[model samples]
Target chain A: MTANARANILSRLRATTTQGSFAVPDAPVIAGLALSLEERIDRLRRMLETMHAEVQVVSSSAWLGALKARLRARGLNGLLYGAETPLGAALEAAWEDDLPPLVPYSESVEQCREQLFHIDAGITTTRGAIAENGALILWPSAAEPRLMSLTPGLHIAVLEAGMIFNTFAEAIDQQAWLQEGMPTNALLISGPSKTADIELTLTFGVHGPKELVVFILT
Target chain B: MTKTADVLAFERNVTKALDDGQLRRNLRSAMTTLSQRRRALFADVEAFEKLRTQGQSIRRRALSRLPELLEQLEARCTANGIQVHWAETTAEANAICLDIIRRHGAQRVIKGKSMVSEEMHLNHFLEEQGIEALETDLGEYIIQLDGETPSHIIVPAIHKNKDQIAHLFHDRIPDAPYTEVVEELNAIARQELREKFRAGEVGVSGVNFAVAETGTLCLVENEGNGRMCTTAPPVHIALMGLEKVVEKLQDVPPLLRLLTGSATGQPITTYFNMITAPRRPGELDGPREVHLVILDNGRSSIYGDPERRATLQCIRCGACLNHCPIYTRLGGHAYGHVYPGPIGSILTPQLEGLDEAGVMASASTFCGACEEVCPVKIPFTEILRMLRNEAYARGESEHDVKGHGYRYTTVEALSWKSWALYNTSPGLARIGSQILGKLGQHLPMIGPLKEWTRTRIPPPFAPKSLHQLAQERGLDDDR
Candidate 1:
């Protein structure tokens, strides 16, 4: 039945003769494509901050310490991280007894769904960032599950400065996303979850993370 | 659910909407803020026009090859392990969804913001089958709670103010406190919907853009509910109008930017999720199964006509709704369709036919504000005029629009035809005006002018015809 329906619809569309072939135009140049690395970082930070997300620029050697300090300062109980990655291993190595517990996403969502929803914060490493819209591109994998940047109340993302692109098209092009098959889910997260649904009042953290803190490894 | 589809009922709804003080205030403030934000975001006129042209061309290209692109999209999605289904009508689409749910044995279905689902009335259909469908978007959730259809497209609950929402939450939710704070109200909804998301067995969503090259479904949302509904549930189903398909992966960014910026004046939404396939092997978390349902639902007819196919170029941004003077005055409820405002004026008539919805085409004032704000540059004034023409003259031409000649009446048609004839012949015109100038004001209010005179004072006609006075003054033939 469905096959017949598909054939009928397609045949109807094909039967109708339309005029003129649509010529696909060349990709227009996007703004902010010519900014320096510093300019790009500045643009991203300003835009994210306007949306109420926090950003901190620190050296790769100091991001973990900054992450710990920021989490402690916010009084978050535990920080969720992926134990399979190098950054996760480094955090695990630098663990201190008095610091907040670092919870690793080691189990399937079915087994850890309850804990994930109640966790204080979850941090994941971003594949890259878009400076034009102030967004972080995430390619969720098995190690860092899709929910790491979601589910938790506070989401902390780690981005290297060099990975920042001036626009989303640039990120897609530089990463060769067309050549490489897209992951099950690819996301561009600009700020924490928000809505202006109630009388156009801007409210954050309606469903996803309330706070999105990015640590740019300079 | 509730529908005000017929011509009389639509006019009645418009009258009632126009009289509602609270609704008027809410719509006025909301529309102003939305249009202001969009203008502020696209402040650079030159840059904005360039993006609009590029966006329009992209949509035109996709629609020009809609069938081929849809086929490519299906094959690519199937290769990516995502099941694709086709439905020629809304009923078929609903049945396909129900079948998917039955196969999964899913009792709880959570949905993100989907206008397509609303068009199918999927929630109402599911309830009859003893399945519960929960709305996860905050605006949709509010509307679902009250058993009301969405008034606006992007913001479903834009017609309600904070105080109304506060009262609603306090009355509806168990042990909920009455609070007018926006943040608190949002938190209450978050808490209520989170449990549903956690337990949702099947997730349903609307695809914003489906890429033919990568077979990806892109969803744009500011709230995280879209993510939860698509990601947390074991089985995910996405519904889309066949027109939503795009050409390639690169076609996404430009459209996405225009969509979010024009829809909510956001540079980008909080989340732009691209779903290529279901959970891959060894994937710890993601939907186990993904299904894409492409629905025609009168769109194929709209696509058949070369001139009318521009209707499909709309990205459902709601910018037209925000800027329309008629929409702002009467609100979306007056239109009495799933879509409202200028786009609805042309779309509902074509989709539902002129017999049931032809009156909606006359709802516009031909202000051209909708065309000015449309991201894809849909010539709305021209389309509305075309639909109006089809409504009155459906039998006059071989047109694909449904319900042609629905509004055509012998008396009205004859009156117009005679009026056209009188204007072309000076002898008949002078004779007609001589009679009208003598008895026009004293004649009984009848015909179409009967309704016009019921509200407005009739204008007095001069005793002397203009042509008579011109000849009395000895004016030349040219004058």
Candidate 2:
């Protein structure tokens, strides 16, 4: 790239950042909004039912182990059990084969970001679900880079038994728990990446991941 | 090159396409896949419809304020240090492009896929002026080498299968062997295009949408060729239709959502580059001089007619093409125009002129499927009907004689009025029907009933009319 070309790109970038032309309408921050864990889980169940997507719930440590075993049986790779396990050891264990390695758990969120750029799939916790648009929101902080959830083709998100909401408005209204500030990144993934550009012929997995798998842990 | 009437030429081409079973199969398979993908992507019915309405209204609003917006866009673009040029026709647009190339002393041009350029036949014109124009997009590069026009809008070389592509590649490349694998063919083309991208002096592309507020041009694509073409050359030129503009930046997201979803059934394309101006002093990878050529070949005239004004809402997603039954059967080449689908059936005639290209208007089943799937919600079937009416008025229709005969016999003559009066009174209508039925049975063939009887037995004239039958059955008289 020429110096002139680099200057042009930087100038355009500066102009855009300073112009504030692409600013979205600022969302209002509300206080004292809360939902019980059971209510959230139930709302999620209803939304999934409407979309004809399946949902599974697991609670016991023994059952979680069995679920991992079953996922392996179904040809899913990089299965790592993170509970009571060192984050580094789990990462190494997940990297056993040619199949995409998965981390079962991370002791620290920072470990997740280090492994994110190379991983093909990520199973992470969702802060909450918005009912209005049927979206699952994930926040990226210093511990977890935004790229981990976005770069992968398959995002297997595990929501706690009670974090789902009925609408996106409700999800936005319920963001009072953060102590420091909003995370640098938030991804609202609704479905898999798809395309129908070729002769209007639909082909999945053009650029983004072809599939999205979400699990609810009771 | 051909001076034949567009409708007559189109009819001949469509007839040939209908006979090619292989082409029909390829189109059908591709269309089916596209329709399924679109269906999956737009599962949220309410949101999808809302977006469609928004897109339609935005385009309509933009067209109403087009002249003003174009002036505004030109001013802002010029202020941003990008040169803007206006062309009233394809000839003018081509001349301006050539003049720019000549001024820069450019010998080689690498082009991204721009349908407006295709409409103007810019490649041929440029080549005539002794400049090499390379199509950098993979699909376009293949068809360029094949020496054929693009068969589809989004995917240019859609009609050709892998085997045919392999054969074409083998013939074109000196050392490359013919291969069926797609990756190998792509690699060969990639290798061939990389040199053009590196060495070309001019880069040309089509603008998906030009933001009037900030004087930004948006190019959305899955392949990286558009980026390469825009950034590789010192001189970058964009040929945009006058209709491809939106008022503000916020309007862009909704339009993008609809365009990407309708075109490829994707939420968004891989690359959505918003280019504001030419490369500034410190930019690493952008053109030094950016030129935007706004072409209004025949669109201004279209905006004047209320019946055809809705045609301007087209985002060129080609969803109507995928769902159109006639288009799937006939393929793009059969349309004998740059656009070749449901939208094409209505738009081509208007832009090219109804007297010459109106036959395409009658090609629809009026199933309303095109309108249903249209991202910008163009009332395609209704526009088609209006075009057909215009065709008939100009005596340009193949069915003109039949249409005229019907109009003369039914509308010009008052015999049908007398017949209607007789039918109004149930007793009189029944008696007349009985007489006509007796005459028909006795004299084997005669009058208006003769031709009707020759094809198949006409409905037997009943002794009792429908009203009497209804009354006898105790149904409501009004019904």
Candidate 3:
């Protein structure tokens, strides 16, 4: 039945469709912002902050120290992270005897359901950032997965300053994620979970992370 | 599920909607904020115009190569371990969704905001099969609880004010105290819908954009309910309009830019979840089984008509609705369809044909505000005029025109014929004016013109015809 339906619709479309090439456009740069990379990153910082998401940019030499200090300030004690990512291994290696235990994402949704909800914060690496929109692009990997960013109360994303693209189009095209087959899920998170459903009034953190704190490693 | 789709009953519905002073106030305030926010966001008029042009070209190209794109999309999605289904009508779409639910034996289904599902009235269909489909989006949840369809696309409960929602919550939920605070109301819904999300065996969502190259379905939402619905459930089923597919991943961002900006003036929505495949092996958390239903409920007919095919470019942003004077004045309810406002005026008829939803074409003021605000630049007013012409030419008055029945009835057709006769002959025009003036003096405001004159005074007929006066003044060419 479904096959018949599919063929019927496709036949209708194909009958009218012309066989031709198309113009694939370049990702246009934002017209007004004639700024350099450094300037764009600064603009991203301000934009994210305006939306109530905290953002900080630091040099790679100071990246680990800055992240640790920020997490401690937020009182995010328990952490679930990807065991195989570069940042994950570094954080695990840096853990001291007195620090909170590091938990790795489970291989299945059911296997980690309990730990996912109980964790105070989850950390992951963003594939890239769109500076113009103040968005962090995170392509879920087997190790990082979807729940790492979704279930935790606080999502702390680590992004490289160089990964920042001026527009989402630039970020998408530059990455060419399709070349290696897209991950199960990829996310472009701008701010914390929010809703204005009730009488059109804005309320933050309804379902996903209540707070999204980004650390940009230069 | 409680559809006001009898566009035939538009007058009664509009009367009821207009009587609710609270609804008017709510719609007025909401529309004002949306428009103001949008204007402020696109302060650089040139930048905004450039994006719209780019967005339009992207949509146009997608349609021009739709079949190949759709075939490629289906194959890619299948390769990604996602099941693909085709639905030629709303009935087929509903049946397909129910079959998926039955396969999963899913008693509880959490639904994200999907206008496609609403177009099929899927919730009611599920209810018939003894399955509970819970709306997870806060706006949708409110409307669901209230037994009403979403009045607006993006803001589903834009029709209800805080006080009304607080009352609804207090009445429906046990232990939910009466409070008009937005945060509190949201918290109450969050607590309720979250439990459903966890309990549901299946999640259903609508697609904002479907990428053919990547087999990725992009779902955009400010509320994370969409995430919960798609992520928490073991099975995720997405229903999309056939026209939502884009040829390339690059095609997505530009269209998305217009969607979020024109929809709510947001730089970006909170979550832009791209589902390229179901949860991969060894993935900790994501839907295991994914299905995508590409639905064509009269969309092919619309596609075949080249001039009007631009209607397919709508991203369902609801910007045109926010800016439309008729929509804001009457609110969505008065339009009497699952979709409403300017887009609905043309779309409802195009998708379902003019017999059922044709009355919507006349609902617009043709102010062209909708076209001006449309992100993809759908020439909405032009389409509305085209639909009107189609309806009149076919004498589709057999379909109800509600309170303004005369507009679509034989009376309207004869009125045009008579006017054509009078215009073609000057003697007939002079005589027609005297007769119309006599009729005007004696007649009470009645028929289709009654609705118009309810709050307006009819202009008195001229004592003499302009053509007659032109002839008398030896200026016959002016006639």
Candidate 4:
């Protein structure tokens, strides 16, 4: 029955001819003009800031301290992240001082569901950044699935400076998004969860992260 | 305006909406503010126009190859481990969704804001089957709590103000716990819906754009409910109209640009989820099973027509609703359906058949603001007129309207015919004017014209005819 319905719809649609001919325009590979990587990163930071996200660039030697200080400032005590991630390895090795519990996403969600509710923050490594829209494209893999970015109250994303692009088109084309095997989920997150539904008040943290803090690797 | 065993009286609906001063005030202020935000975003006039043109062409190109693209979408989505279903009607769609829930032995489902689900009246259907479907979007949640349909697409509860919403929360919940502060009201809903998301067995959402190339379904939202629904639940079910498919992934950005800029004046929504499939092996916390239901309720009939096919190009932005003079005044309830405003004025009649929903064709004043603000540039005013013509043709036969309705009675049509005849011939026009002048009545309480004169004073006839006065002044032009 489902196959029959599908065929019926396709047959009717195939016979359809719209009133006028339309010339299909070529989708430009890059929507905005190219800029130096430094300029692109600055623009990305500025745009993300405009969307109410906190952004900063730090040298490799100073980033871990900066990350810890920023997390403490937000009163975020416990951290949730992917254990096998490079970020995790660096933080583990850098911890000569006392630190909070680092909950690994390697645990299945059901096993960690109760603790996930109380965790102060979750962090993930972004695949790249789209500078024009201040978006972080995270392609969910087996290691870090979607919930790591969404379930927590505060979401902190780390992006390398070299991974920034001028537009989403460039990101897709440069990465060969579809040609390469893609993940089961991906997202273009601009800022924290927000809503203007109630009398047009711009309130954040409605369902997703209340605050989005980004650390750019310089 | 009351629902009575599935009978819809559009006139009564309009009267009820117009009588509520709060509804009028709420819609007026919100629509004005929304359209202003939209206008502010298009400050770059040249770039904005170019983008709209590009958006329209993308939609046209997609529609031009819809069957092929849909086939590609199904195959690619299947390859990505997403189970896709096809339904030819709203009944079939509801049944399929219910079956999926039954398979999991689930009795509770959480829903994101989906106009497709509303069109199927999915909540009511699920209730009958002893399953609870909770609306998670804040605006939709408010309307659902009140047992009402959405009054507007983007802002579903645009008809209610802060006080009313606060009252609703106080009245409906177990205890009247919160004040009417806007942020507090939002917090109340957030606190309530969070537990529903965690406990639900299945999640339902609407697809904004289904990319055929990557088999990715794009869901856009400003709030986190969309994320929670698709991410927290064990099984995810997505509903999309057949026309929502685009051929390539890159075709998305231009449309997304126009949609955000035109709809809510944002660069991009906060969350853009590209779901290629359910949870893969060794992954945590996405739906274990993903199902995509493609609905074809009355869209194929619209596709059968050539010129009317352009109606399918709409991106559901609600810009048309904001700009439409009639819709902004009447509110969405006046349309008496899930869709409202200028798009609804034409779409409902065609979908429900002209005989039943044809009165909507006459709901417009033929203003072009809807087309001017439409992101994809659907010719709404022209379509309204075509539907009116179709309504008149249908109204001519008693059989066509036997179980449905008549937009215009024969008496009204004949009255307009005689009125047109008098205006064309000067001699008859003079006699008719002389009779009205001698009667000393400014407005006539006669026939279908009474419906018009109820709210307006009929203009009195001149003391002398234009032809007569022109000849007396020696200014009559002989053509």
Encode model 3's per-residue lDDT on A81-167: one tens digit a residue.
899989899998777545556788855877767677768888899898888888889988887888889878888899999888888
Residue A92 displacement in candidate 1 (angstroms): 1.2
* Candidate 2 vs 3: which has more lDDT: 3
What does candidate 1's lDDT look like per residue over B382-462, in tens digits?
888888888777455556578887777788888888999999999998888889888887888787689898889998988
iRMSD, per candidate, in listed order: 2.1, 14.1, 4.4, 3.4
lDDT of 4 by residue, B1-479 (tens): 21222235877787888888888898889989999999998888777777888788888789878888999999999998999999999999999999999999999999998999988999999999999999999889998989999988888988888898999999997775758888888888888887787787999999999999889999989898998889888899999999999988988888887887787888788888889988888887788899999999888767766567788898999999999988888899888878899888877777777666677777888878999888888888878877766555543432122223335467767878999999998889778777766674655577646867889977776677676687788885674
User: Could you give the DockQ of candidate 1?
Assistant: 0.67
Q: Any runs in candidate 1 off by more than 4 Å, and if so which? A: A17-32, A73-75, B1-5, B394-396, B462-479
Superior candidate under DockQ, 1 versus 2 = 1
Q: Chain B vs. true chain B: TM-score for each candidate? A: 0.96, 0.85, 0.91, 0.89
Error of 1 at A189 (Å): 0.4
Q: Rate the local accuracy (lDDT) of all candidates.
A: 0.90, 0.66, 0.83, 0.83
Per-residue error for B289 in candidate 2, Å, reads 0.9
lDDT of 2: 0.66
Indicate the residue-level lDDT of B458 in model 1.
Answer: 90
Ranking by TM-score: 1, 3, 4, 2
Q: Among all windows of ten consecutive residues in candidate 2 chain B, which has the lowest summed lDDT?
A: B398-407
- Tens digits of per-residue lDDT, candidate 1, A143-186, equal 99998888999899999999999889989998999998888999
